[model samples]
Target chain A: MSLPAEERVVVTGWSCLTALGANTETSWSRLLNQEYARGPISCFPTDGCRVTEGAEVVLPELPWLPKKAESRLSRASRLALPAAREALQHAGLLDPAGRSKLGHLEMSLSTTATSMERIEAFVRQVWEGKSPIQQAGRVASYQAQQQVNDLQTFLGFSGPAAVVSNACAGGANSIGHAFDLIRAGLVDIVLTGGYDILCELVFCGFDSLQAMSPDRCRPFDVNRNGLMLGEGAAFLVLESESHARRRGVPILGVLAGYGHTTDTFHLTQPAPDGTPLEKAIRKALEQSATSPSELGYINAHGTGTPFNDRAEAQAFTRCLGANASGVRLSSTKAAIGHTLGAAGSIEAVLCLKTLQTGQIPPQLHTTDPEPLVANMLARPGALLEKNAALSVNLGFGGSNAALLFKTP
Target chain B: MNTPLSILSWGAVSPGGLGVEALENFQNWPTTVASEVADPARQHLVATIDASILPEKWRMRPRFRRASPISHYMIEAAAQALAPHPQIERNRLGLIYVSFIGCSVYSIRFYRQFQKDGRRFASPMLFPETVANSPLSHLAAELEIGGPVYSQIGDKSCWSSALRTAACWLHNGDAEQVLVIGAEEFEPHQLEAFRSMRWLAKPYTRPFAEGAGAVLLGKGPHSGRPSIVSLKDGFCFRSRNESRTAAERCLAEFAPNLPVLDSAVGWIRPVAIAALKGRTVHDGIPALAHEAFGASCAWDTIRAAQRLSIHPEERVLIPYWGLSQQIGAAALEGTP
Candidate 1:
């Protein structure tokens, strides 16, 4: 399954703004310390909901945005643009004009909620009769494309862009699409990532589903409850190995393979048997041509919900077989909360860091590991024999995505 | 260059009626329906589907009944496309669901309930459907498609992107067959927005109607199907000059010498016309302005398939300019 050198996609630059920190370095340090960033929700009122805590990103200001653009863009877009800008700068694509000149650059963004805060504001105005029906048109324009348009305007980019809205799997799906595009020689450079913001709409919705934990999320634990919501954004600069070599840029890690599958068994729940998740993991391993024994770490999609943790544990056992005992498994969601759409990308960046730094972050707050995952990380950090790792994300709509990465 | 893919089957649910036949019939004799918007002072003409026309099985399914109307439209359209090949392996099929705004009505309902009645009153049933991927998941569950399912959120130009993605999936062996669907359901907020934007014509114009369009794409030179000669997308044209440049570059690759059939809608028509200046291009094709918001691209592709089916020796270039800055163009060659 080895790909041609020209077709192999690698991550050259990456940036993440998670609840744990504003940048990758800070977040990595916090994770290393087993810090939990969950606190009482301040972004919106949670008077009637059982869930009161969340992992929120507190930024001083989006200095890169123009004053005029700030008023027009949504809060989610504000969070996303800075991360994208950082990624481009890290990749050396940013120029003196505050724009990237790389020809044929493409962008694919993923999100579960695109500017829901703006939509809620507009709707509130409409409900209060403060705004006319014509003014509500602004709400109509609050789709995922608005984020792309904002990024394009801010970066002065003129290329193809797409929005992948696959719930929590969006981040991984965006990166997967970028990999396929570059691997197929469709484009040389792609800026792909995911972002979401805390909003009343999603909060109340999750509350209704009873899918939120009252306390800090504890993944892979026997006493695990539901998930805690979080807000953040992450972006990666993915390019073909040949393209990276031509520009003499540093490669952070190789995006060896990706696999996407749907349960089709339920709309909001994973298949109890975990067959769908196992298939996705197997497909990713097969595509990357890496044996399960070679994988050093497994960033499980441990949402902390009882069903999700149990199902994912079953999947690990079924897919890894005997190698399950050797893999160091952990879930960053315990530290950062569930970023939903941005979870996969943020975790992927963490995987790249783990590969580069050889430090496996601990699975915070898990007192007792699920029996199925024989090698769940209970300590602070561990060294890896092989730098290859896997990050998995399962989202609403039974969407599952797995990404495989190795040290460059 | 890669080998072309075939359009094995297609289904559409348009304003005129249901199924691909309805789309074809409406193309010959167009009709319009009266629709009301949030601005109660006036009534805007729209092409809306009659839900009663959908098959009983779809309407009666428990999941379908609980799903949103937009989900129903996509499922019905996909059902039509899949009806032709019942023997195809469900696991080998992939689905790419494309839409501009997904289930706005449900989103509004969920949010409105939460705002009015507080968090405890929020509806769990509606929350899942509010996400853009809900419809794709429902369609997959109904069809039992376990392969890779993706939901692409964009305007008209998404059609080209969807097609390109479907082709990529085929080339990458992700799925043996892929169903590319573009769908939009009429909601009061969307109608209000379109009216406010002045995109809707007065008196419920022809060709512009609410509908869903679907096509089954597979690696080709298959029997009795037109081959997609070349598909290209990801052209961002914010201005006329940029549109012209992107169009010129795209045409140079897909159809430098062949006669083109332009299918751009709304503000993008001029850009497409400018790009095809001084070239052998056809422009009299009826616009699907009455179809649902995103249906124009799918309708145009269907029209391209129809034209190629008649003129097997010709290659037609279809250029798409979305309301957003996204631009896409495709070349389709007929086969006999």
Candidate 2:
């Protein structure tokens, strides 16, 4: 499963927009400071739902794009473009004059709610018998492809673009696909990421499932009830090592391995035993050629739900075995809440930052760690080992993904 | 670029009818292409499927009680494809589902409920089906496909991408056999959107259709199936002319010296026609239109495989272009 030197995919540039801040630096600082971003939901009415708090990203106008283009973009696309632009610029690939270098570039985006707001508006029009099909089609941008299409048009990227829609695992799977494409030599560089925005559909959906926590999310805590929804986007500029070397860009980290699995047990619930998740973690480690003893930190899926946190905790013990107690584990979801489809990439950026700074942001809002994972849970302001780290994501339809990253 | 894979079995559920039999007897099937939209003035031809044709077992299954129409189409098509090889281990099977607009019916319902009745009325059942991966998940659960599964959301060229993923998975030893499905459901709103975008042709010459088609891919050559020669995909950003040029260049890169039977559909037809025009054009190649169905790639691939299966000496070339300027091409050769 190991890739050759020429085929090894490395992270050259990365950017993220989270509820805590607009950029990576600001978000990282806020995370380290243990600041909670959750607040009363204001984007839409949470009238009947018990849960009213969420981490909503306040979007700012992008001067880089034309006013018309900005106005036309869906909220999801608007959040994604800035993060992608920042990643490309960080990799020194954003210059319009150097667009030819992007001939082999590709883009993969992930999202659970792509323009749900616009779709809601369209639905309202249709329901009222005031349907303006043409204008609604232009305004709604309801199809998942429209997100990628908007990015392609805005960035002028000619390479293949696709959207992975596996709910919460969408982001991680998107990055995993990018890694595979690079390793298989299909493309030299890939702009891979995930984005999602706060909408009534998601908020009410989670509420109806009875899986939303009314209070702040507390990951790996005995009293953890349910997850709190959040919104944001994250992107990583992944390139084959040889391509990065040729371009002379700084390597932030190496995308060591990725593993994906599905739990056919249920459509919305994790398997109680966490067997599938453990297998996914083992697969990632096996593919990366890294031993459990070499692992430093784990960014748990840790949605703070009763099922997800417990299952993930058991998965850690089963996968890491003797090394489980020694590895630093925490869920940043406590600080930024759960970003849904964007959770994987956003957590991945945090993992890369942990590798760079040797600081593992603590699991915020959890004073009492769950008994099973207490020994592995990192406290506030804990220092991490400068080694390999693992980030995992689990989605609604039992889709699971684990990504392994290491300092170069 | 490496050795091609084989298409062991295939199935389809289109306006023509259900399963491979319907596809084979398509000519005799009634052509019911008309608008399903509420507005009479905005009428546009669309091919609709009859869900009543699905098997009782599939319809009565508890898992599919709340399933969307697209999911039903996909499950039925997949069942037909897997019917021939029940001995294949479920654990070694993978699923890759592609669509232009996924689960639009459920999406509209979910949004409408939220917009009208407020947040509390959002149905949890409808919410799960609203996601793009709903069909793929439903199919995997129904068939017990425990291996790697991926759901891709893209324009028309997504078929080539699905093929590429399946090939890679097989090549890398991830799955012994992969079922790739392209399914689309007929929704009134979607047709309205298509009409607004002018994607539907006027005068009802070629009607857009809704259906699902599937191809079961396995390693090496099968006794009676066609082997996939190559699959290539690319994105074009410059202009329409540049996109066509880029598509042609990519098509040329796949089996350049071989004589190809052009079966391109929709906007990609010009690219295939141009490639053939440069060389000597061949007669007897089928004239398929894009407006047949949203899963046109699946139909095109199935047709090409059938043709190549009969004519072993000829290679079938399939090219696709999306409204977003994404382009892709595939080559299939028959095994004697």
Candidate 3:
């Protein structure tokens, strides 16, 4: 059943932090200019990692937060607070001082490895038979919910919160659940997004899996090797149409549809045929009552791995059918690397930008496009006016989620 | 938001035993055992589950062959919940796994190996399970479920939050039945952290426990079945006074006159005291079930459903006082 006019969800604000830039506008501009953010690891020594280059964020100074209070936050929360503040400020829901203007607002955030760096340090201390009292706060901040808690405590929103940790698709899943909450008339507004930071254990794990690109991330390219790890955060403000109108805020776009499905085929590997992802795409389109032909732009998951890119390309071809050749598609991972859990939401912010300003971000470093998506890749500075844009993510555990955004 | 959900079936793999019956009479099942602590003078009270409690058939399943204990508990509890309803379509069932500290055992194992060796020595197989959603993903893969599934991280009161999300899914016709599970596994680091925080109980103050609890919810009409009538949650608190105030406000808005299914473990918490003031409270489950962390509220919910099954005329209110952050309440009524 479709929601009533008053309960329909709309996006009022969005922000992202990526290696390319610190905010959505800068990231989008740098992305259009084809500036690659991949470089050698500097924050921590990449001693034995098979892959050394990564996309790490250079955080801006947050003088608003006390120095002592900020010290307690993990890197994930450190990246999230600024992005969340920018989103709220963009939506006119908060003042410049990082305080909430609304009475009650909920939150739905996602993360795969929440505060792993802190947990690693804590584990080392404990394993060494040393006193872990100093690291107790770090251990307590290890769960994925800790970031949400930090956001609530920082933003001063006293609404319900949920943290979705469905691997890479977590970002879209969090946004999707937020949309569902508003559409179901459970809550009027929600601040939804996802964040993840680079940690030694996770980076080494991907290297152990041989999923990292030794060279550069070349998604949808015929000679693509694997993905490059990145760290960042992205947030969006979604509210019911009635609530937006009541607050007198300008609507950026409409959160048209959300499709969440599982690919029980394999834990790490998606089904080679890409049927499950196709089903997710179809489900999203069905919810919005928008045909495949209506979709103007698509932000493909395109992790630059063999199985993921091939399966995602196949899913797009099958779902879009004839429209596949005409629809503009690109993978921003080629520029900023794959931000893991933040990929879906960061790409979502890009999709909304494309929906609003017809300037589709180009796929970087793809010398020879794969046969499947060769005709669909966008050119640099390509301007294609599209009313609707689709963003999809295929996570590590065969979770596929799609979010469709339409111009209001 | 106030959608009535029929409790199709329930399951548990608590310190008591394997099913809801084990929880219904958990007080007589076994007593809490003492586990060794870092201090030589005293020990910590623990209620851990044995691996043998799981069905032998699960061992042969390739999907669960290398799964962690938390995954096993989650799958076993969900299997039990779906056991009686053989005709329920797997593709139409949604799964939501809620946990506070999730899969810490596997995380510790993976990190330990990585620290011992080098970055290249990090086990790929173990790394994927380090994420909070790993157990739920394993359960979904094992059961071959193709519906919407999510892994929500929160304190004990998140069980009520999951119920609210499940209710939304049911209201939107996303699934015929939504299986909500709260699962946690034992890890020494967690115990040590608890000890350091002084939240750990010495003898019998408030024993710490780990296990899984699940309930299958649907919007279908089933006479005499226990159904959730109201859920008043999203009461975020910062301190004890705030928690008590939140609990009082939640109870007032949810079901002020219903018999309360209290979530107090053993101590007289400020939130519990506020909820227990002039109310018909059922504190037996928390007294016997111990504190399963994230699974605590699920246990309380399952016990409320069981109470409704026997006394169809009673309406039960469950007020949840989380370890931190939020407070909530769920109201359940049995149909005539």
Candidate 4:
């Protein structure tokens, strides 16, 4: 699956902000220890809500961000700015020496809602007879690209930007699109990933669907009820291999292949047959020229919902055959609750970290695993040599995507 | 340089009316403007699409029964672009939905119910459409297109990004053809926001409008078709003062010598006009509807393609000055 040196895309740097911690290293360390981030929802009222537990991030202060425009920035942008800044800094793009390439850096980020929380507040104010004119900034930030705008303006990146809003699979879609851009030689560098913030509207919507777990997020567990919502942002600096080599920066991993497909079956529910998901997985493997046995780890979309986990497990079995049980599998959602739009990118960062550390993140808070996934689920914390890893995500509206990352 | 893409076909649902012919015959259509009191102190001028203009076949489809108006406009446009080419493999067709303000009508309605009925009684039906991708998924399902599908959100200039993405898809062999859609639904809150920001044009001067536009793109030089010659986007600006410079720079990087299809209106129109000074610029605002957000660019692109079709030896350039942050330009030429 390796492309020519000029076309090969590599991950140069990555950073994430999750409930487990404010940065990638902290989240990864806590994840290995099986430290779960679920707790009582504190960002907003959950008095009458069925599921009260969710993960919320406490962001660190970013002094470089202009203070005058702070109020106009959405919580999603606040979370994304620090992650992208760290990513750029890690990739050395923040240095004056590397600043010349900023204009060529295309941005592909994803989110379900940019500032839905602010939009809710704006609507309520309008209902209370408040002037819509006064709260107009909130409406401006409602578009998901507002976050991308914030990142680009703050970081001084003047690249063509795309904001994916494919619900849960958005993050992976953004990254996948970035890979496509690089492989097509449209841009040599890209700032990509996804971010979402927990809002009452989204939380209530899931609760109304009875898709929120009443107890805890237990992915692939026989007793699994549903998912717990969470908020965070993750970003990666992607560059063509030739660009990375010219810059002499460490190539974290090779983004070998990307496969995305749509399941036209339903808007909210994935097809139980998992045929579309299987197609997505097969496409990724075929594109990468990697066998199922070569995949060392799988970061499942396991939302702890019965429908999602079952379908995903079926897809793995259908696509991997006997190799399904051989590849170590886990859902980081067990540590940081289902981040919705941010899930795929967060897990992509986790997959790269997993390959780097050779540490498999365990499926936490589960007693009895579902029969379909029992054989492949990771047991506790285990270190093993890794070659390539897969991160798969299924979104609302039947958007299914799988990303394969290989060691460079 | 990116691979030049050929436009196989195009479609639109603009303030003028449904289908690209309406845009071609724009002078005959009356401007339907509504005065709205989005702010008690100020009256806003808005141009909304007539729902009755949607074809009965598209309007009555079971898949679109509960869908938002934006979805209806987008699907209708997509149908116009794809229906004629039934021979194209569905599995080899990709879709990209681009928008600035997504599904605001549904999102506002969903939140209103959530507020009035409390969180426990929130309606799940309206919540799904609140996400920008809802309509895109519907488009894929109704069209039975199983290829790669995505929803991209940005300003008017994002059209350039979507075009580039579609070109990449076509070039990668992921899909033989890619459908790019730019759509926006009329919503009161959106109007209120524009009015509050003083971005709305004077009534009848260049009012903000809503609608959808779509184009089917493929690789190679198809004779008699309009092909994208070059694209230069990502001219980021931090302020109004910087926008003119960005537009000029983007134009220079694109094809500065070609006749321009301008996608700028409202306060940013001057920036676009200044950048292409002395050039033969076709102001599409009069024909395609002014200040249509994402659709503004789409209409301009579709019009440029039409122009190229009629004038086979000519090349057209488009300069897009978005409401905020960025500028972009695209060049198109009719194939020999």
Top candidate, metric TM-score: 3
lDDT of 2 by residue, B1-336 (tens): 355889988888887788766665555555454553446566655567877878778778777889899989899889888999989998888888888777888877877777677677677778888877877877888888888888887677777878887877786667899999988887777665665455554332355677889999998887768998777786553444776677667666765555555445444455556756655333545555435434777877777777777787777667665654567777788888
DockQ, all models: 0.54, 0.49, 0.59, 0.60
TM-score of each: 0.94, 0.93, 0.96, 0.95
| Tens digits of per-residue lDDT for model 3, B41-106 | 345656778778788888778878888889988988899889989999999999999998888888
- C-alpha lDDT of residue A273 in model 2: 88
Model 1 regions more than 4 Å off: A1-7, A130-137, B27-38, B196-198, B201-208, B239-262, B279-285, B289-291
List candidate 2 stretches off by more than 4 Å: A1-7, A96-101, A131-140, B30-41, B201-205, B221-224, B237-243, B254-285, B288-294
| Per-candidate count of clashing residue pairs (backbone under 3 Å) | 11, 0, 0, 0
Report the error of model 1 at residue A259, Å: 1.5
Fraction of native contacts under 8 Å reproduced by each candidate: 0.61, 0.49, 0.63, 0.74
DockQ of 4: 0.60
Off by over 4 Å in 4: A1-7, A64-72, A96-104, B27-42, B201-205, B283-287
Worst 10 residues of 4 chain A by lDDT: A95-104
Per-residue lDDT of A270-310 in model 1, one digit per residue for the tens?
99878898888888998889999999998988999988988
Tens-digit lDDT track of model 2 for A1-408 = 224654678999898899998889989999999898989888777887768889988886888777987988888887888887777887788776423247467787788888788766665565566646445455437666677766776776666776777889989988988887777666678899999999887788888777888887899999988887899999999988988999998899999989899887777788998988988899899989999999999999999999988889999998888988779999999888788889999999999999999999888888888888899888887888658999999988888999999998
lDDT of 1 at B97: 88
Model 4: which docking level applies? medium
Q: Distance from true position, residue A84, model 1, in Å?
A: 1.1
The better-scoring model by TM-score among 3 and 4 is 3
Please, what is the whole-model Cα lDDT of each candidate in the order they appear? 0.80, 0.79, 0.83, 0.83
Question: In model 1, what lDDT does residue B270 have?
Answer: 63
